[model samples]
Target: MNNAAQYDTVIVGGGPAGLTAALALTRYRHRTLVAESPAAPRNAASRGVHGMIGLEGATPAEVRARAWAELDAYGLTERRDTTADDIAPAPEGGFRTMLGDGTQVWSRTVLLATGVIDIHPDVEGFAACWGRTVIHCPFCIGWENADRTWGLVADDADYAAMAATGFRAWSADVIAIAPPGMDRAEETQRALRAAGSDLVQGEITRLHHHDGDLYAVEMADGTLIDRQTLLWAPPQRQVPLVTRLTDTLGLALDDDGFVTVGADQQTSIPGLYAAGDLTTAWEQGAMNAAGAGARAADAVHFAHPA
Candidate 1:
């Protein structure tokens, strides 16, 4: 058998959460290996990392590169641009991970910074407008585009109504475009109208954009509505690694498909941890992911006191 290389921790991602956790461990002088996936990051479509102070408006790639650049200075953390193919509990109370290149590494603990996958609508122009004009969270990208015409394209009537009504703080012109056959509660409909939001029912055909900026939404009936941005919070699925872990290790997942974690980011399995959008459905931004990573790192560091 090949000798298993060991480290204090192995982070299964290299995005905001994984990089943040690696930084914390390096600060504490812990030996770590960050196995970043070869796949494109979840936020690659995002224009920039929003609502994160000190690093506001930075591109996702820029944020990750900046963090990874700091690793050389510490010399305590190692990085590999490879995916973690398999992870299994070690016989001696640690973990054995297989990299994409078939290298095996053992670690005392594993941090699953693997993020979630955002699902987008199946329509033309949505891809081009995504991250630039089509956004998911208002709080994350609303402030910059305030006062502009906004469209909430949601399948759930309750969420559509709530978002349309709630977005009034950002703009006076808010519209809830519900999918065909979706019905809203009377109370929600009243609230939307009271908030001065126009509610429309139709199948979104396409989002028209000019010069990469969103301009309007075209419906199946060929009706065009002028709008600058679309608030589309699509359902997200766990990354392959997270799903595999849940199946193989029996990690508990909440109804929303997020891995359940405690106050310190530890997963249902002891010594195994998770953070970022993979852990929650709300407050999922770069800043929150970084904070969660730091917290998870602290728990891992303190648990293995030197």
Candidate 2:
């Protein structure tokens, strides 16, 4: 085996979280390596990234490209086309990782920014309308598509409450579609009714699209509801890197299958940290990832103060 390549820190996945952490570490004069399997396509489906300063309406690829450019200018070493396969505890109180191409890297600290994947609802032609008319986030797409007919597709009662709050700004004519056995609370029903939203009871059978635009949703009972836009919360699953590394390093995962991290973003395993969506179930975008990455870098700096 080749000798382990050493750096002050190694960051896995070059999304907003990893890039932000790498930039912060570089400013502190720490040698950092960023392993990116490949950049995502510009047309990849995402509603929009919210809460990012000066980039409220930006798409995921747009935000990532801008961040990458900024980090590149700062001389951060980026390893495109490389993937971290496994991470193990190092004897000298750090961590060692194996790359997909058989390269080994040793670092004083490791930060995982591997993002989560959205579990899309099984609806016909829904993929084509994603990121355009069928969106996942209200904070991101509500302002853009305001005053249009919006449909909130959900199967959980709690999600109905959350969706009620989020979709209030877009349009007063919101429809909450819930499956059987999931009853909305009295307060939730009152609030939604007060907001002028009608509760539609049915399991969505399929999405109807016309010329790549969302047209309507068909219910299982043959009910067709015309809608201009569809919004819903996505069930999420962590990227495979989280599971691979956790198993390799024997790190602990929380009940929700997220990497268990303290306030400092440090995992149960020493010298290893995780931030962003990999550690949280809440809906977070570029802003949250960037903030978490910065905090993780600062925490690592404290642990190994120069």
Candidate 3:
């Protein structure tokens, strides 16, 4: 059995959120370790990261590499490229984290940046088109695709209705794709139709694409909707690491199963904090996640000052 090491803070997940927190903790002089699993980032398929000022057109890999480069100069953060298996409250008023390789580490505080996984529908070519023509964030890809044929997929009526209206700003021709069992009220649907958009109420069987550039969305009943890009938010659930911890720790969760944190990003359980996608469902992206990490760092630092 490997002996447990000690640190002031231990951050799980090495995506943008975890990286940002590590950098903030280092600046605050907190000894920290970033424990990352082998799982690729949620945005790994993305060709470019947007909505982050000054980093326009930067690929996700480039953004991560650059963050690491800046952190390396400080030399105050230790990184472990492995999964954090479990976390238990130490008898001595700290945290004991078990790593995937049977190594245990102790820390005064633990931050969970463990992100969620998006569950796309079982449609052909959907996975392949992700991060490209299968648009996740309109703000991230809207400008380049301005005035192109666009599609909106949503399960909720209000969500689809609101999104359909908002999408008109990007393209006059919009198709709202509602999955099975989804329907908007007549007034809402009427309003959408009144705004120069069409609603397709059915499951999509396939997305036709060539080299990740979407060309058409195929409905289940042999209907083809020509579209250049589609905007959708697939369902999401917490990663296994997060699920286990939330269950064992009795952390409070929102309606959508996201960890409910205070403004400071501290979870209901003291000494345990969560940031990024694990903390919220709305406004998801690299930029929002990085900001959450900084907020959690501030709370952790304030809790235990140098």
TM-score of each: 0.94, 0.88, 0.95
Q: What is the lDDT of residue 102 in candidate 2?
A: 78
Ranking by TM-score: 3, 1, 2
| Model 2 vs. true fold: TM | 0.88
Stretches of candidate 2 off by over 4 Å are: 39-43, 47-50, 56-59, 162-166, 183-195
lDDT string for model 2 (237-284, tens) is 767778776666577888888788898989888778888888887746
Lowest-sum lDDT 10-residue window in model 3: 180-189
Clashing pairs in 2: none
For all candidates in order, the CA lDDT equals 0.85, 0.77, 0.85
RMSD per candidate (Å) reads 1.7, 2.7, 1.7
Candidate 2 structure lDDT: 0.77
Q: Write the per-residue lDDT of candidate 1 for residues 63-129, one digit (tens) a residue.
A: 8878878887899999888999888999888899999978999998999998888887798898888
Span of 10 residues, lowest total lDDT, candidate 1: 180-189
Candidate 3 lDDT tens digits, 1-306: 135799999999888799999999999999999997776888889778877888888888898789888888898888888989899999888899999988899999999998898998788998989887887778877876788898888777777776456876688778677866665445556777887766777778999999888999888888998998998878899888778877898888899999999998998889899999888877677889999999999999999864
The TM-score measured for candidate 1 stands at 0.94
Number of backbone collisions per candidate: 0, 0, 0
